[model samples]
Target: MSWPGGYGRRVLAEVDSTNAEAARLADTLAGPEWICALRQTAARGRRGRPWANPPGNFAATLVFRPEGDARQVALRSFVAALALYDALASLTRAEAALSLKWPNDVLLSGGKVAGILLEYPAGPGGPLAIGVGVNLIAAPGAEAVEPGAVPPVSVLAETGVRLSPEGVLDALAEAYARHEGALVTYGFGPIREAWLARAARVGEVITARTGREERRGTFETVDDDGNLVLKTAEGRVRIAAADVFF
Candidate 1:
């Protein structure tokens, strides 16, 4: 269940459902870098929708039991996004164009390249897990996406980057270490700066989706509380958890 060195415990070589397995382990087995990976897992996006986690694609969960509050735990999504951005940067020349959509979706040239899902226990002071899925190769079909939802893309085999899922995992963990230090010191501000530096153009009209509600508006910047600011025709709005499309 454990790998040598700082590498996480590899639960199985499943073709489906890494998140489910990791979620089960979060209560008992997960420590720092307690990982569960799947060669192929079902894609469930932010709003209870299916994602495409095909073979050769990246589907894994990185569990962290930080001694912090919900605020810090929620900030893990941003930290994970930064880690992924750094990993992809090492693999491609189009690194400058990478951006973090609100919440924790990673975007490359306007299409979704990766997503981060944060899962935690209901009560206080419990462990938490983050599920990250990147399109290393092949995207979901139109049937898997909502009618108006934005299309998606992959990194490997498309960005001229030949990366195995393990390679991505390694690079991401290293990147997370660097940002985690900053998180411990200066809080999410410093990490958010790094995220915005790679983000797509803000203040542009786009669609934002939470599980319950959806809206179209101009994208504002992320506030200090990590909430996304949207300038809708209705007014300026803040979304606590939602998938952003720009």
Candidate 2:
């Protein structure tokens, strides 16, 4: 797919994972806003989990070598979520209700529509890579998604959205540049406004996983550090990581 900006996309018929492939090329690739789109991907999703990437579905990775700090990494995910949201919204009025789940996940009327995975290389001078997967033609089995959570949704011929994987990829890159520019120039103050406009909700009960025990609380706000602030029974809390839900 072609984008008007100085952006470019490299197509892959199939790959083990776009994020992994991008990581392999990080040192050699010189392009700043490089994107890799895969027709099929194996073992996708954040935290190295598996996501069903059936043929003809959307699977892609966008690698960015930002002139920003790790503290500003949340902007990457926010821009990604907004891009997907705007694309889907433009394609279908049914998707007008799309919202963003904190950190990174796209929700269509409260059900998951897309998921984003951000990878930051270890050590200094490492850039961030974001992997995004959307159920274009098919949703995953219940066993594959978060348990006891909202059912999944998709955008494809089935949803009457008539969107193609290539179209989504194009939209992602274009939308990303716009939002990322806003973030870099204006800081998170404005990005947070755009995010909150489509955010899941405040005061909604959620559980955050931290690799240890789970913390349950009401969603508060996005703190200055980009961490999610959850208001528990004790007090407001900051969460660096979590599998959130309402």
Candidate 3:
């Protein structure tokens, strides 16, 4: 399958974090590149939450130089999530239960089966890394997750079809290529529509927490800039970064 920017690919037996490794290789790599790890000793999710993947799970990162403002580039997380949704929907019999959660998560049967994380350098117009972790064969139990984090699920559990990590990676790479191309050609409008169609909850009540502040509101649609639009009794709020809960 064709990768974004025709970048190189590497699969490793182990790594600290695919995002970190991608950053280290950004300067040397010409364009977009992918790094997949069989296992991660120091995996992490959004907000530095420790992420531990079992042997059969998938951990991969894509490093690329985007051609736009840093804020625009950050929206690639949504694209990545959509790509995963597409891959999972095409591969699983339980497609009806699959949905994309706001910001950066894919839900299967109301449980999180995959997540996307985006990272960039200190300044703008530099190389950015997109990290994706899929619970293909196994998912951590409740004891392994954070106190209030969403419960996890695996594709195998949801579909009764076991998929190898490499198989998932190949499908992900192809799906991402399609969505990334769409984003470049059409813009965020099309991507937004596609995402909203598969969104977990819209027009539902939800809570968003960031730092020490919390806001409860009706979950509205995402704005053009990819901010989560929330309608609270006080007023309309745009959430750029927060942990959303239903």
Clashes of each: 2, 0, 0
Per-residue CA lDDT of model 3 for 114-211, tens digit only, reads: 98888874345678899999998888898886566679998898889888767777778888888888899999899999999999879998888899
Best by lDDT: 3
Q: Provide the global lDDT of candidate 2 against the true structure.
A: 0.76
**What is candidate 1's lDDT per residue for 192-240, written digit by digit as tens?**
7877777675757888877688888877788777888889878899888
**For every model shown, what is its TM-score relative to the native structure?**
0.87, 0.91, 0.94
In terms of TM-score, the best-performing candidate is: 3
Score residue 3 of candidate 1 by CA lDDT: 31
Q: If both were scored by TM-score, which would come out higher, candidate 2 or candidate 3?
A: 3
Give the winner by TM-score: 1 or 2. Answer: 2
lDDT of 3: 0.86
Q: Model 2 segments beyond 4 Å from truth?
A: 1-4, 121-124
TM-score of 1: 0.87
How many collisions between residues are there in candidate 3? 0
Query: What lDDT would each prediction earn against the true structure?
Result: 0.73, 0.76, 0.86
